[model samples]
Target chain A: MKKRGIGIGSIFYGTGYGNGFPDVSKAVAQLKSDGKIAIYVGATEVGQGAKTALSQIAAEVLGLSVDDIVFINEDTSITPDSGTAAASRQTYNTGNAIKLACEKLKRDILEVAKDYLGLNSIVGLTLKNGYVYPKTLPEKRVSLGEISESLESSLKEEAVFTAQTTEMDEETGQGAPYWPYTFSACGVEVEVDTETGRVEIIRAVLAQDVGRAINPELIEGQIDGGFAMGAGYALYEDLKIEKGKIKNNSFTNYLIPTSLDMPDIEKVIIEDPESTAPYGAKGIGEPVMIPVAPAILNAIYDAVGVRMTEIPVTPEKLLKAIKEKEMTYNEGKN
Target chain B: MKKIKLTVNKKEYMLEIKEDTRLIDLLRDVLGFTGVKEGCGEGECGACTVIMDGDIVNSCLVLAFQADGKEIITIEGVESEEEIHPIQQAFLDVGAVQCGFCTPGMILSAKALLDKNPSPTREEIRAAISGNLCRCTGYNKIVDAIERAALYLKRGK
Candidate 1:
């Protein structure tokens, strides 16, 4: 017989560096000859799709297609200082910087258009689809490429965004440590074999509040990857060490969840936009993993009534715990 | 050092290498097929999975001498100059490629499975790529890509 149970876990993760400032800078430049926009930021894409997401933000601001925005990122010499890709700050920090830079570039384009078109007032001018036009009069419009070809200089602008966070009090250890916090809840279903103490996760449903999802597909990918790592942490992965030396350093010994080990995952995204963030987007990278382990652990306890505190809840430990719990119950009855 | 002749990616090559050289090193270093990544020198991660005589084998575990006369296929072999393979397209369509470290190996494993069984169940697909470890995407999209690739193959797309 198989015993199945379900459990839930929730978490609140603070974005940006904890108790420290996070900075992001972006530069937007238009090619003088081709009028193509290039965005430069030092944000690394370690499978979180930072490049695609930030490019989307720039495209939204510049009124250009995402394909038209060329990203020059992760190169220190070329791109400005966008801090490390940790603490889930790229989407919020770098995104805002890119937005600001694009906004500045748009202003520069309008300034150039006002002078070139010989218009007295640039009130109703708007940038749309690589063209500048008056809101009411579409005929009196000029292609951005034409403006660039006519101008002697290219359009270039840069902006920096620094996230503000209060330092933790030395005596009280309490203060606003980060800019924004992302909250998430995960529910897991599991099956426990009482004889072997093996716990198999059957399904996982994660509900995350990501101020806004710039790309829903990318968000789902992050969530799914995070859940796999979380599942490995809960039941399969163990880094053995002996006398301060590492053991089980190879993949064969240090087990990660394989395709066979993963369970069905359901994602529920809740959008609670952040006013300060670009496109009202917050970070979802780290928050997706926070609740997974606890949810699986809770499911295991619900199934077999064993409180597993250690990670990698291996068969030996779980079996021992189960036996100990049964013995304690029998002793009390006797 | 020994002289060995093998067919790789439908091209034949005669090379001089040490008997102990691993197939992964031969493919990546000697032949410049850098698509074959080595995550673990051991056979566990399956990051170096390649097709050898119509079956998937971990390239890191196979000695170069043992590969003599055996036809080998790496990720580079899966696509032509004009178009990518149906499996590669399926991976892209299903959003399976992420960090892409595990993509080449995972695709080869799927290829091996699909070559043997054009119509595989979800569980069979999972079991086929069980040896391949991907730190990104949680294997869900990869599985989806494989299933979609199977459909494409069945429809002769």
Candidate 2:
């Protein structure tokens, strides 16, 4: 156990996200000897890639491959009591915790590195491919096995962290603000069938401001997922709620966009690395879905002159608007 | 209970199930294949889509007995150990999965479409996966992934 350099910083307003920067080499050493690591951050994969992202964070800190990390997304037993993996906060908040733990581990390893080579700064020490090396001397790299040997001789300590923010002004729903806000916008074009009231999204161009992308492929996957859900919300998807009961609890009653309802989409990734994140990456999970519903709603109005305030524009609703407009025009002509 | 011998992912599994047992249940509970999920448990949502003899069918709608002696392909069978299925890779590469609950079914539906028509128009691709519902990502990316997969398969890569 040694003094660790760890700082938790709030990155954005309204994001309810904070991060702890950790030392990587030490965490790996601890992992090598500890056999298993526990995490309580309330990030659930649920297909949002939170598990993978968190694993990547641990892997990056410990100088291990993504496979070396195992995240317990479910079973609250092993996980930290952080918040849900929503608001694009997991990558920022939970990732920081992994970094903090890694920092403490790094401190332990530094002591070992000092005693091993009798040096003050491991500045010349480069961590690459799961090995620590003196940059000037490539062959002078210490294998993880050797580091683990040192960890077993040394005393160990717990790495605990929690990311938090103050509650909002209950009346106005405003607070200190999102610690970090991921911004995005989408441009959509649609073709509305005058006869059938079927709206087909012709093309969609999206621009997202992700603080940083931990995994580019995964980021886009999140974006695509958001769009699908949003598309369903727009033209063909709706949850039928009647008498406070979920009428469309089953898929039959709830109409989500199918592959048939898919629209042509173009993804534009914008990266503004947040200083607080690992490699300056922000969370892209929830932001993908937040702006989409509104974007689609706006696009529908753009395509058809009618502004359907409500969502899931059923054909009947669109037809009713069309008829109302026609009647108004006819009355004027008369 | 009737004994149903089905071939899934090139492996034969003999299941003694009730006649009313949906293929989805057989795959999930009986066979321990969680890849084929049950979102709606009805045909309305394509969460339980699987390929049967090169055609996509909702496993929830198909009775387990109907799948007896049938060639079934779940998402697990789509890929060899060496590489991922073209559709799955496309989905991953192009960002098609989120809350991946609907992904297996969505990919299978896309596979069925591609098997029937190698080169599908945008409309056709849309028609192919139209049954599946994804709540996280908009359908735009799913369609993009399918379109990309079609090109990848055409190039024989």
lDDT of 2 by residue, B1-157 (tens): 8988999999998878997898888888888878998877667778888999888898989999999989999988899889998888898787777767888888898888898898888778777777777676656677778899999998984
lDDT of 2 by residue, A1-334 (tens): 1111111111122454433222111111234453333333555677767777778777776667776555555666654455665556667776776677766765666566656766667776765565766778777666555666666454343444444444567688765444555677766666777677777666666667787778877777676766777667777667667889987676556666665665555777888888767667777665665566666666556656677778778888887886788788899999
Candidate 2: C-alpha lDDT: 0.69
Location of the lowest summed lDDT over 10 successive residues in candidate 1 chain A: A22-31
On residues A1-334, what C-alpha lDDT tens digit does candidate 1 reach at each position? 4688899999998998868654544555554467678888889998889999999998898788987888888888887788899889999998998898888888888888888777877788988888898887878888888888987777788888888788899999999998888899999999988888888899989999999989998888888999999999999989888999888888767888999889879999999999999989999998999899999999989998888999989888889998999999999999
lDDT of each: 0.89, 0.69
Tell me what TM-score chain B of candidate 2 gets against the true chain B: 0.94
lDDT of 1 by residue, B71-156 (tens): 99999999988999999999999888889998999999999999999999989999999999999899998998999999998898
Query: Alpha-carbon error at B32 in model 2, in Å?
Result: 5.2
Candidate 2 runs further than 4 Å off: A1-13, A17-29, A34-42, A62-64, A67-75, A120-123, A153-175, B1-21, B25-35, B76-95, B137-157
The stretch of ten residues in a row with the least summed lDDT in candidate 2 chain A is A1-10
